[model samples]
Target: MEVEADEEAALLSRPRARHIKKRALKNKALSVSFDEKDLKDFVGGFHKRKKKRRKEAELLVQEAQRRKRIEARKKRKLERESVYGGAVPATDSGSDECGEDDEQDEGSELVTSISGTATYDNGDMKVTVTTSEISREEDKFPSEKMQAAGTQINWRS
Candidate 1:
């Protein structure tokens, strides 16, 4: 009798499912839509889209390189301006460090030209080489210019 009463109490304590109201205004159906052509292209045109993106990225990189080259050129111009005391130096202008005048530099080219001729010998199968060099100022050498200029001509510069 106690077991039967316990079973009856347990059944009474269990909760039962309740039915939902069918006339709920907030619970409504959704109307979904999609473009079939766009969906198909998105799924199938992977390589085409990737190629276009790669080309755009390449153009961006090229533009960046061009900008970098321009900036570097500007920096070099600034450096040249600093070296030349805010003036753009001419090709033949004299330098202060060496103090070489263009007139003196033109005069100091002692060996103006050097030419050679090769004569082929048939009997002995030998070639005779004859070379001649022309000097502009053999008497007035660099020694005289060095004495007046007080510095050696830095041809390497």
Candidate 2:
């Protein structure tokens, strides 16, 4: 009798439960629509942001170029000092080691003289010359020793 009463009490205290179904709305039915002008405005804003980014990139590039020039000039100064063992003298005239002057004449003077001249009558003529010299001794390859050196050679096609 006590067990039956405990079972009845447990059944009375149990909470009731129910299943609920949620219906999903169609994407096309629920989607918000925008006009052409709205889309154009959004694109325009994106382009403006892109332009600002490009300007910032250009500024970065300019700064990098300036730094590179400064570094190159400093390196050149260091190299000059290292080569000269000290700072260059202020009175030292800047000139090339192979002192080439721009104003110096570089051409040979052409001399003309009235030499003898011959009159020619039109006639076809051809001349050919060939020469040969023979050597007393000729150098030959040391094939016997080269073969004795135990070198392997492979030829394939």
Candidate 3:
């Protein structure tokens, strides 16, 4: 027991080494001690890489926005086509077709141009296009209601 106490006293009397914490380099990161010139070079390189990465990210964002706009336009076009029963409307001149051409024109013809007007009131100009089916020649241009409202409708030749 005296020998054990002596050993314990010796152990306790010994000067202890201070605990020093060692810093580990993070994953994929380098810890470097450099002179002033080397630090300037490192900082310049880091800034250049940061700028390049930022530019690339911006380009990717712009490309995604462009793709979204194009997709939206395509979707709108598809929706319009579906709403029109899969056939797009066609433009029509003032010329009339024979009854024999009705069958041939059914698949192609959609809405014919009935009338259009451009009104300029106090520098505020507005243009309006009116479209309708022109199956019969006897069909009036302005219709009875428009004519009754004193509207001057002109039929294009």
Q: Tens digit of lDDT per residue, candidate 1, span 1-157?
A: 9999999999888867765677764587777789999989988799789999999999999999767655655565566565554666567343423433323433332233456666666774655554554233433486775564444222221
TM-score, per-candidate, Cα-based: 0.34, 0.36, 0.34
Best candidate, TM-score-wise? 2
Which residue pairs show backbone clashes in model 3? none
Per-residue accuracy of model 2 over 1-157 as CA lDDT, tens digit each: 9999999999888866754445433333466887999899988999899999999999999999767655654554455555444656455454323334312312323233333433333355332222222122211345654573334232222
Give the clashing residue pairs of candidate 1, or none.
none
Per-model C-alpha lDDT, please? 0.59, 0.53, 0.56
Candidate 3 C-alpha error for residue 42, in Å: 0.7
lDDT per residue (tens digit) for residues 4-78 in model 3: 999999989987785544554234466687699988898899999999999999999999976765565456446
Candidates 2 and 3 compared: the better one by lDDT is: 3
Q: Show the colliding residue pairs in model 2.
A: none
How do the candidates rank by TM-score, highest first? 2, 3, 1
Score candidate 3 by lDDT: 0.56
